[model samples]
Target chain A: MLKLDNIKTYYGNIQALKGISLEVKKGEIICLIGANGAGKSTTLMSISGIEPPRSGSIFLEGIDITGMPAHQIVTMGLSQVPEGRRIFPQLSVLENLDMGAYLRRDKEEQKRDLEYVFDLFPILSQRRNQSGGTLSGGEQQMLAISRALMAKPRILLMDEPSLGLAPIIVQQIFGIITRINKEQGTTIFLVEQNANQALKIADRGYVLQNGMIVKSDTSSALMADEEVKNAYLGV
Target chain B: MKYFLQLVLAGLTKGSIYALIALGYTMVYGIIKLINFAHGEIYMIGAFTALIVGGALQITTGLSPLTILAISLAAAIFFSSGYGVTMEKIAYKPLRNAPRLTALISAIGMSLILQNYVLLAQTSDFLPFRSMIPNFPFLTPGKSLVTTTQLVILITTVVVMVILTLLIKFTRTGKAMRATSQDKVMAQLVGIDINKVITFTFAVGSATAAIGGVLIANHTGQINFYIGFLAGIKAFVAAVLGGIGSIPGAVLGSLVLGMTESFGAGYISSAYEDVFAFIILILILIFKPSGLLGRNEIEKV
Candidate 1:
């Protein structure tokens, strides 16, 4: 499990997250639904150590990982598929995936993970030698997720995987996310603007508004809540 | 025909050195988008290190020429790479989050500091670089001749290029480097130590520049503190001409620049050789702003 204790993050003098706290239990799909500038990405970034919180601590299992360097956080079994599928445009698909497992020394396990990734996204295998930039948006997103999976992470932090994708593609990606959580037993902390799709797949959900968490409940309850429906789901 | 062959051979010899130095520029530019003006100083230091190590070995020990050459080359590479890494840590790392112009100004400052340090440490006058290779007969029996040293430079450059290409293509560290160059944050999220990769790039680039300094000094038989300035400028021009961040582009640009200078001097006038090189660069830039091998990447919204 991962826990954040009253974390406060800032961008220079401007506060981004004001005493935000959240929890992601093991093997659960937890989604954070918020509008633009709601500090969803900021929360994930603070946890991932890209932008460390100015105040309070983050814990993975029982270990304090507050203010650790980003690379070290990844080694501690956390990985992120950033908002934009920031794949190396010049590198071949295989090389990009290879970079995902950069810290792992176990060759056999790496090979197995690579095979699993290829199987999960067959398009990646087909275009294994092509440059990542040349891929379609959906394909690039798939490659990004597959690349993150190559790390064999205990927790995968995905920021807007459904952003800028077609509805069908979004459905497919969400299905994959669901399968990943149920079958692989990997904990996921998903941040999404698509509340309808996200809440459907998530076991639990939290609503963030203006750098603060306003609601947290079971996904079904959040879906049924009149305010949640009006504000987010547009139901 | 023989004269043409001689010009081509000489051009290749000079081109190989430019290519070596240009690789350093391109690699650093690719990773951090810094021009690294101090890179030339690293080359000068490399030549100095080789000179000191080779001279000391000759005076203190009775070693074979080949052994001395190996030892001196290794020392130069090691020392120059260390200087490269140090320069990055002290001058560039602090300014990583600052504006790009700040880094550029810092690079120019670093260059001045390195040049002055070398001038104070070693004499500003040109120092002779003794040939390490044993004498060998010319490949051709005509006026247009190929010496053993020219052959050595060409062969060494080719071998190094091949090895570098392989390193960037097949290695895990290379993949990490490519990843870092593409997106530093994503690379970190994937558990790559960005600082380590950047340092490795600087070290490898400096090592190549070191070898270039050693070979070029040996070829010309003289080196000075200010030699790196002109050579570095020419190599920078080559890197830009080839597409600043592309590896093969750097080599291509160097060869083209070298051939232009050689042919210009041979057919026209030696005094206008540098002009010829710059003319080619300007022409290339005018026509293809991205350089010969560089792709104009479209920004995805």
Candidate 2:
């Protein structure tokens, strides 16, 4: 479980996250949806400790993690699959995967996780020895997600996995997201601009507007809401 | 042909020394994007340490020449590595998020501080360094093209190069270093303590520079507090020439620069050797600023 309480974050004098409060129970896929610059990524970044909130506190399984460094947060079993799939360009695919499990010293567990990721994306295994920069966008995305999975974290935070992806690939990625949750029983906190796809898979969703949470409800209720449909669903 | 062979041998010997020093520059620059202007002073400190240790051993004990040199070399690595890590911690670590210009100014300041510290602690005059390498029959001073010192320099360089390549390509910490250099944010997401990686890089790079400092002191048989200045500048040029962020590029640049100086001074006017080195740099930067093997675009440090 993860929780945020009235967190405020700033970039110099300008406030990007005015005051955000939300929570996700264990083993559930929770998504935060908003338009561009509505603070979706900022929220995730705050939780990940890359952009720490200036005020309020964040908790992971009731452990306060405010003001923690990014690496420390990761060691606490929190992993982030950041936007743009920033795979180390010059490193081979296998090397990138190796970096994901950087903290894990147990050889057997790392190998098992490696095999699991390879099974999730067979193309990645095919391009195992090739440099990550040489991979296609779809393969890169898959690698990015698989890299996060390789961390074997108890909770995973993903930002805009469907961005710039084709509709079919988005569907495939979303299916895998659902599958990863069901099979691994890992808790996921996803941030997305694609409200339609995100709501389809999320159990509960929150709508962020200008760094404030405007609405929070179950996915079905949000899907039927008139304002939500017109503003974000684009129907 | 004899003269030519001698010149080639001399150039390679000089180039190998430059390569060792330039590696420190390239490795430091690769990780933090800081030019580490103090790197030259670290080399200077290394040489000073070897001189002190080597001289002290001569007076204090009846050690063999090889044994004294080995002890001096170890002391150089220890002191140089310590200074390097301390310099980063004191000067550069706090400025991790500061502007590039700020960090660079800090580096220059650190360099000046170390230079002055040595100038005050040790005499600024050139100190005589006894060449401790055991002379071999085949490597007799006038009998072979390569002197004993030159042969050791070349062989030591090759061995160091081979080990460094293997470490970066195969070792876990080395892989983590490459990963950290590539993406700091993602590296953290994977739970790598970046500060530790940075400290390790400084230690290794400084150790290599220390080896260079000691070797060059042995080869030249003389040293001063200011020796690091010219050597550091030349090595910096070598790093930039080969591509500041690339490893092999530093070695290539050092060799090319060494040959240019050697052949230029050998055949052309010897007085303008420094001028010739700069001319080559200007031409290469004009044509391909990314450097011979560089992948990143030009961002002068």
Best by DockQ: 1
The CAPRI quality class of candidate 1 comes to high
Which residue pairs show collisions in model 2? Answer: none
B154-175, model 1: which lDDT tens digit per residue?
Answer: 9999999999999998888887
Minimum summed lDDT over a 10-residue window in model 1 chain A is located at A114-123
Query: Model 2: how far is B78 from its true place, Å?
Result: 1.0
Give model 2's docking category. medium
Q: What is the TM-score of each candidate against the true structure?
A: 0.97, 0.98
For candidate 2, lDDT tens digit of each residue in A1-235? 9999999999989999989999999999999999999999889889988889999999999999999988899988899889888888889999999988888889899999999988888899999999988887778889999998888888999999998889998998999999999999989999999999999999999999999999999999999999999999999
Q: Rate the local accuracy (lDDT) of all candidates.
A: 0.91, 0.91
Instruction: Compute the lDDT of residue A122 as modeled in candidate 1.
Output: 88
Model 1 agreement with the true structure over A86-189: per-residue lDDT tens digits: 88888889888888888888999999988888878888999999998889999999999999998999999999999999999999999999888887899999
